[model samples]
Target: MQVSIVGSGYVGTTIAACFADLGHEVVNIDIDEDIVETINSGTPPIHEDGLPELVGKHAGQDGTGRLRATTDYDSIFATDATFLCLPTPQADDGSIDLSVMETGATQLGKTLEATEDWHTVVVKSTVIPGTTEDVITPILEEESEKTAGEHFGVGMNPEFLREGTAVHDFLNPDKIVLGADDDRALADMHDIFEPLVTKSDAPVVEPDTRTAEMIKYANNSFLAAKVSLINDIGNICKEYGIDAYEVADAIGLDDRISEQFLRSGVGWGGSCFGKDVAAISAAAREREYDPAMLRAAVEVNDRQPNRLLSLMDDHVDVSGERVAVLGLAFKPGTDDIRNSRAIPVIEGLQERNADIVAYDPVAAENMRERYPNISYASNPAAVLDGAAAALIVTDWEEITELDAEFDAMTTPVVIDGRRAIDRRDGIVYEGLTW
Candidate 1:
């Protein structure tokens, strides 16, 4: 299969690499010349596990000629399918702002107008229900001046790739969803993922386009709400001086709950949960339905940072003192800080007039761009030296394995937001929810 991927961002770049690795010829289309050149030169533009090796293997520089990149939509005419991976950022009203998707659709439609060959367009980016049909299909039809099912097939194929393990997840998905009204589009989608399904033996789910779109929202919202529910229970456990993890462990034995998201820590902060929940909640309101559980979940997650800070406040006054912040990325195994819990922790430290030093194995530089004035340490030990207190935001392995670093702190008061530290002698340890 010859595949063309639009928008060489995280999802786009990752799937392109995965497809090419599965023996499909792939062409990545992007507006940025630097990104295009980087891909063609066999280098990945982003930081993800197993990405560099894939790019090095199939990106055409080594003469395998399985993968390449271009800046022109003209490349789409040559491929059997094009996956729309454009960004659908949150609007001011909490719905998805489709301006980027619209622009990409317009360009794609214009490029299709020049060719008579049949092509399938799959929406890979996350969007609310009715977006692909009510919003995007009309734009593509108007620009191309062609009937959708007859000339170009439209489909919705939601990606379930998690950050930090995107490649592994895509290659080994638990399910593959193929959503399309047109039979040809659905067939093409099956052809696109046949290699993966054969490789991983993952189940295939076929539904209408709208249901597929809602599936993504439903999946994310449930996990987000589950985390929030556990966090609430953990808060209660903390109030009663009970161990939350022990409670979580006991309840996890129930097969009904399954216990995937029972780790109640400083709450979830990443590209997916907050935006997807807000979008779904806002969409429900637009339809005149109130989503109470979703709203409560968001409220619980939003209050977690303040609770972690309050725990720190219980120990020592941080004003005019050095406070070590141990982790910046939203979660470990990646260097993304889009909605990291560390952001609010740092801001809280600033409000208390505490001088902050932070450390992460790969995310310190990224966080530095957002906060240039804070001191970034070369190692986790560097952040703890002579610090009055330390606040743990992300559960990076370096911070989790710290058994004696508390001795270096001026005040051995450690606030554990992610349960990254153990309770021991000679130091006061506080878990965010324990």
Candidate 2:
């Protein structure tokens, strides 16, 4: 199968690389010349685990001449399938702005108009419901002057790859969902992903395009709900003098609950959860549905970063005090800081006039680049010197393994935002929502 991915971001890169590894010819398309050049030069555009090595191994290989990068619109017409992996950023009204998808669809439509061969365009980017048929299809049809499902079919195939382990998740997906009414489009998809399905029992669902588009939002919101629910429980436990970690452990033992995303922390911060939940709730409101619970989840998740600041104030006055922040990324194992809780936490402390020094194993460069005013030291210990308080925002393993003596601190205070640190004597230890 020859596929053209229309974005070179995290999802696009991983999708292109995975398909190429599976023996399919893939041309990853992007408008940026630097990104295209880096990919063509056998370098990864984004910093991800095992992605650089994977791209290095297959980027220029002739046998797997499968994987290539380009900025040309002519390549879109040559591929058997065009996967739209463009960004659908959140709008001011909290709804997903589909302008990027619209642009991609319009460009592909122009390519379709100029070409003679047929192709299937799959919406792999996370989009609002009905986008494939209601929004994108119309543009593609209007620009190309061709009927969908006959000349060039359209489908909704969302990607579900976690940032840290995206490559592994892409190859071994939980399921392969293809939403298309056109038989030829469905057949083309089955032929492309057949090897993956044949290797294991992967369910393939063929729902309406709207249903498929909604599934991505629903799935991410549900996971975000789980995180917020646990954090809410943790907050209740904090007020009632109980350990939220223990409560979660007990709840996780239940066969029905299943302990994924139950870890309580400063809250979820990434490109997906924040945007998806907000967009879904806003969309629901537009459709006359009162998504109170979903909105509450978003509120609780938003308040988590400030909760850490309040915890700091309750324990000690951070004004004019030296503080050491242990982590800067939204989570461990990735340098991505989009909507990270650390931002508010750092800003809140700074507003209190605290002298802050932060350290993150992988995210220091990004943190420094984003917040140059704040001091980003080389190591955790370097940031801890003469600090009155130590706060952990990201649950990086090295911070938990830190053997620094608490007696060396001016105040000996440690606040765990992710509950990563255990209780220790001689040091005043407090955890967020714990």
Candidate 3:
């Protein structure tokens, strides 16, 4: 299979490397020259586990040269399939802004205008239902001046890769979803994923294009809601002096309520959950349907940070005091801080007029772009020194072993959001939902 992926962001780069590793010739096309060069140099543009090794094995001068990156849209003409991995960022009104996808589709259509061989364009990016058939198909048809199913095929193959473990997830997926109306498009998708399916022995889900699109949104929205529900239950458990983890453990014994997404803390904040939930909610509203439970999930998640802040306030007066934030990334293993809970925690501390010192193992640089005013410490101990209280937002592996760092703090008050710390002898530890 010859695969061309548009956009060299996290999903794009990861998939391109994985495809090449699967013995498919892959070319990643992106507008960023630096990203293209980096991919061609056998280094991943983004930080992901096991990605560099795969990219290095198949790309670059020393490798097989099966995987390479280019900025030219014309490169798609040579590939049998092009995956549109562009970003669908949320607009101000909560609907997805598909301008990036639209532009990519237009350019792809123009590039395929002169080609006679049948090509398949797969929508790998998450979008609202009806977007593929209604929005993207028309743009491609208009630009190419060719019938979609006859001349070119379109398919919707939603990715189920999670950050921090994208390579493992891709290779060992739970299920493979193939969405297309036409037989040719469906066969092409199956052919592309045949290697993965045989290797992973994952279930294959064959749905219509719209259903596949909805599957991605529904999948993310449900996980977000589950986290919020656990957080809500965790909040109530805290009021009655109960350990939420214990409750989660017992409930997880039930076959229906699984153990995943049960750990409640400051709530989920990443590129997928918040944006997908918001987009789906907006889509539901557009059809004159109110998604009340989804809206409540957002409310519960939003209030969790304040609840953590209030717990901190109960122990110490942070006004005109120094506070250390232990983690900045949404979750450990990556430096992405799109909708991290630490943002609200920091903002709440700012409203209290506290001098903040933040620390993250790898996400400080990214968070610094959003908050350049806050002081960032190189290590956890540095952040704790002279600080009145500390809040743990992310559960980095290094944080779980910080037993002696509290001794340096002015006040050894710890409010753990992810339960990533222990209640040391000298430290007053307060778990968000314990």
Candidate 4:
């Protein structure tokens, strides 16, 4: 299958490379000249594990001629299928702003008007339930002046790829959903994913377009709620002088609860969980439905950073001291700090007028854009030098391996939000949730 992916962001670039690797001729279409040029020159525009190797192998001058990128929307007409991986960024009121995606769809439809070939359009970006069928398909039909089912096939196939492990997750997906309004569109989707399915042996779910969109939201919502629930439990365990990990481990033995998202800490902070949860909760409220549990889960997530800061306050006064912050990325293996728990932790430290120095080998540059005044260290040990208190926000391996670095701190008071470091003898250690 010839696959043309629109919007060469994280999802677009990743899937394009993976599709090419899966033996499909792929062309990624984006408006950004820099991204298109980067991909054309055999490099990835964004940071992701295993992405460079994949892009290098299939694109550019030295690689196979299976994958490439272009800035023209007309490029989609040359392909048999197009996946809309454009952004659906969140609005201030928690609803997703679909203006960007709508513009892309309109352009795709205009370019698609010239093609007589039966093309399948798949919505791979995360959107609300009726977005694909109602918003996208209507725009496509209007711009192209062609009927949806008869002229062009429409489908909704949401992506579940995580930030750090996008390549691994795409190649080894838990489930593959193929959604379509018609049989031809569904069959085309199967043809596109058949090779991947045969290799991974993942289950295939056939559903309508609306159900597929809802699945993405529901999946993230459940995991976000689970994390908050565990954090909530951890808070209670702390009040009663209990080890939250022990309680979590015992409960994890049950098949129903499982062990995933059981590690309770500062809270989940990334592009997906918080955005998806908020969007879905707002969507529910728009229908006059009060999703109390979901809203409460968000509230718990919001307060966890303050809770971690309060723990640090009990150990020492950091107002006039050098406070070292370890790990600024939302998680390990990525440079994204969009909604990192470290943001709130840093904000709390700022409120108290703590002289801050933070370290994350990969994400320091990105965080520098957010906090130019604060000091950034070249290494974790450097960040801990002469610090009064150290706050662990991300559980990066380098931050976790600091057994004796605490001795460098003036106060030697360590407050861990992610339990990155263990409690040792030489330093006063505090774990946010044990």
Candidate 2: tens digits of C-alpha lDDT, residues 1-434: 88899999999998888888777889999999999989887888887888887788779653346688999988876689999999999888898888888998899898899876778888898988888888999998998999998898888887778888888787778887888868888888888888778865678888878888888888899999999999999999999989888888889988899777788888999899999999989989988998998898999999998888887787789898899988888888789888889899889988999998999988888888878988888877788888888888988888888756556788878888988878888788888876
Alpha-carbon RMSD of each model: 0.9, 1.7, 0.8, 0.8
TM-score against truth, every candidate: 0.99, 0.96, 0.99, 0.99
* Comparing 1 and 2 on TM-score, the stronger one: 1
TM match of model 3 to true structure: 0.99
Give the Cα error of residue 403 in candidate 2, in Å: 2.1
2 against 4, candidate with superior TM-score: 4
Worst 10 residues of 1 by lDDT: 58-67
Pairs with backbone N, CA or C atoms under 3 Å apart (clashes), candidate 3: none
**Which residue runs does candidate 4 get wrong by more than 4 Å?**
none
In the range 1-434, model 1's lDDT, one tens digit per residue, is: 99999999889999999999999999999999999999999988888899999998998559377889999899987899999999998888888889999999999989888989999999999999999999889888988999899999999999998888999999999999999989999999999899999999999999989999999999999999999999999999999999999999999999999778999999998889989999999999999999999999999998999999999999899999999999999999889898899999999999999999999999999999999999999998889999989999999888899978789999999999888888999998999887
Instruction: Quote model 4's TM-score.
Output: 0.99
The lDDT per prediction is 0.93, 0.86, 0.93, 0.93
| Model 3, CA-based lDDT | 0.93
lDDT of 2 at 214: 86
lDDT of 1 at 433: 88
Clashing pairs in 2: none
